[model samples]
Target: MKKIGILTINDYNNYGNRLQNYAAQEVLKSLGYHVETVINNTDFNKKNNKSTISNNKIQKIKKITPQKILKKVALLLRNNYFYNKRLETFRNQRIKVFKEFTSSYIIETDISITESNIPNEIVDRYDYFVTGSDQVWNPNYRKGSPIDFLTFAPKNKRIAFAPSFGVSEIPKEYHQNYKKWLTEMHGLSVREEAGAKIIKNLTGRNATVLIDPTLMLTKEKWLSISKLPLNKPKGKYLLTYFLGDISRERKKYIKEIAENNDLQIVNLLQIKEKFAYMAGPDELIDYISTASILCTDSFHGAVFSILLETPFIIYDRENQSSTHSMNSRIDTLLSTFRLESRLAKNIKNNKEIFEVDFSHVQAILDEERRKTYGYLKAVLNI
Candidate 1:
């Protein structure tokens, strides 16, 4: 069998990142290709070693005065003493969840590599390399790394499938670099139209706009792997999967909607909640699938809600700036399915429960899936 290696942001604790990785692997496997996710341990270690918010704050305080330095040390000790159990629990659960999910669903490289350290044996093992279905090209996420551009692969072996820039525009300084790296892709596709436009302007390449790999699978396929949490709420519940901050106004609206609808609000990202903190991809799908209504500020949250045919309200991310806005992904997705009305722009206008008819949405998804499969088949010569 032909072998394919997928390079993506797979080491994160986020539901969307891991699910997209698994989805891409499964899709390729179904095509009769042996697929393995490349685990870059050096990148993973670097991300984990980065200073936390409290550590960064403590660093600022250390330079103030001798007394403040003492206070900073005390604060650090106190925080570690008080929160160690919860922090350890979160870490252990997340690691277990990732291990269980990946071992059961996806194959991964036994050896991890950094950009400067990739083995030729590893490179030669794959017939083709896919760089991927997430924000791998987003500069903020990549931290100026060229790994996501398949720089390690030979020009003829590189393929980009629904890889996202995660921003509306690329910075001017990186245009030349993007052009150079992307010039070598044998087949190119992006998750958003804005990304496709950026590629066109930079490399004069007309990239295809493809659906996320998570959407390439049917709902039945997803449901087959989804496992409900033991403590899943029994009654009708309003599921919230916000990745960004929730404003007071939005919080009020969410509460009001839940109260009026007699629904319990289940927050998937609420750190204070044990259940939320322990949720993995399977639990995430279970919550969205079982929810009476879903509210989120997440791209994957909206994607799964739509796929499950659950009524949902998508909120814009808080504190979006000109250069770093991620709302375009959600905007493009809603527009594609003709479900723009589902966007919760104003609380007053969204007083009633939102209802979505997925019949038309399913038709659009079917056509997009067809195009995506056709692109992959032609590019891989399957």
Candidate 2:
């Protein structure tokens, strides 16, 4: 079998990131490639790239002394100490949840890849190198990570599949490097039309816009691996997942929707919601799959909702007008499915929000999957 190494966002705390990593691996595996995700250990290269110290000293430690709470009672007396402690606990639990999915579903390189240590010997090990169905190209996210573009690999071996810039426009700061790095790739594709447009302007070459890898798999495939959260409600419930702070008005609207749908509300990202906050990727699939309605501002939340054929409302982030806003990707996703009506901008009535039609989604998904497969096959030269 041919060997392929996937370089994506080296994040484990996100549901979408982990899911996309697995999706890319499985899709590549199905195509007869021995796949492993390249782990970017930027955090591990502490000798040369040491992180600056913040006022909160406890944030740096991640080992034995970090767990001893009573011994550090003095720090607890500081302002907002309890709040910081709550956040630390949430991070620990959620990472554990995400780690389970990575361990079971994805194969990773034994040696973590970092800028200083590329493991030069492994450059020839992979027949091809792919960079992602996630926002690996997003400068704000990866800070123009050359690793994402497979800069370490030979030009003929680089392939970009459904990678996102996360914003509508590439910042001026990244333009020069972005152009050179992208121009060198053997194949290029993006998740949103904006990214394709950006590429066209930069390299004067058109990039195919494809659906995210998460949507490439059928709902049945997702359900087969989904595990039920032990504390899932016996009855119907509305699920709320937001990466940014949700407005009070949105919360009121969510409550009204839940009341109208006769469903209990479950806030998955709320740190105080212990059970829901600790939900694994498999449990997250079930949560979204089984939701009466999902109200979220995340791109993947919208992706999964459509795949599961569930009713959902996509919210515009508070930073929608900012250059760093991620609204464009969600805009593209909704537009592609003709579900632009699902985006909550001016709908005042709760009934109008749930009046979504998904009858035509499957056909679209099938075609996008076909296109994704074709692109991957062509890029891999199969």
Candidate 3:
């Protein structure tokens, strides 16, 4: 079997990252290729530490008024506890789940690579290199990391599979860099229409818009690995998987929806609520598949909800700004399935009854899967 090495943001403890990584591996395996996920230990460590530091700095700056500073200091002293412990706890729990679910599923390289140094022996070992199924090309996430561009690989061996830019447009500063790296790829595909447009603008290459790898797999394939917690609530539950902060009004709306529907609200990512700080990719599939309704601000959350045909409401990520907006991915996803009605903004009233007809969705998915498979087959010459 020809060896295929995948480079992606797999070490992050996010549901989408792991699931997409797993999906890419499985998809390639089904084509009879030997696959292994290339773990960049340096980038992994950087992402973990950088996110924590940046978040803390942002929060401190936001709350740095004179009175608020004093209040924060007083609260810190009064609590008499190491608040950083909470963050550590969350990180540890997420790492545990990542190891158990995501890590175990992929064939990982024995040797890890770093951003500054990639061993030539490792680079020459793979017949082909693939980057993506997530926001691997997003400048904000990478902070100018070129690993996703497959720069170290031979020009003919580089392949981009459903890698997303995660933005509607590439910033002007990065256009030249993008052109330099992406122009050499043997095959290029993106996860959204906007991403394809960016590639076209930057490299003058018409890129194919492919479905996320998670969507490329059948629901049965996902269910085969799903795990449900023994303590999962009985009966109807409103499952939420918000990655961003939830606003007061949105929280109230969710609560009201649960109360009216006689459902319990189960938050999957709210660390303070303690609902599910340890949900792995399998558990996430289980939750979405079994939930009576889903409310989320995450791209994978919406994808799973749609795939499972669960009633769902997708809210825009909170406090979206000029530098980064997650709306494009969600918009493209919903539009692809003709499910734009699922956006929370489209609903005039919280009390209004909502439903999704997946009959049409299934047709679209079937066609997309064919196109995606064709692209991969032709590109890999499988």
Please write out the lDDT profile of model 3 over residues 1-382, one tens digit for every residue. Answer: 7999999886657889889999999988888889999987655446645543456655765677876887776675455355677867888877887888855687888887777889879877988999998898887777557788888888888899999988776778788889999898899999888888888888899999888999988888888989986468888899888889899999998998999888988898767655476777788899899998899999898899888888889998887785588788788899999989888878776554346678898899999989988999888887
Q: Put down candidate 2 lDDT per residue, 316-340, tens digits, no spaces.
A: 8774557788988898999999998
Off by over 4 Å in 1: 44-51, 54-77, 346-352
Q: What is the TM-score of each candidate against the true structure?
A: 0.91, 0.90, 0.91
lDDT of 2: 0.86
lDDT of 1: 0.85
Q: Local error of candidate 2 at 156, Å?
A: 0.6
Candidate 3 structure lDDT: 0.83
lDDT of 1 by residue, 42-134 (tens): 564475366655755666775768757787778877887778777777878876987788788888888777877988798789999999999
Better of 2 and 3 by lDDT: 2
**Model 3 regions more than 4 Å off:** 44-74, 77-81, 349-354
CA error at residue 263 for candidate 1, angstroms: 0.9
Candidate structures ordered by lDDT, highest first: 2, 1, 3
The candidate that achieves the highest lDDT relative to the unseen native structure: 2
Quantify all predictions' global Cα lDDT against the true fold: 0.85, 0.86, 0.83
**True lDDT of residue 245, candidate 2:** 82
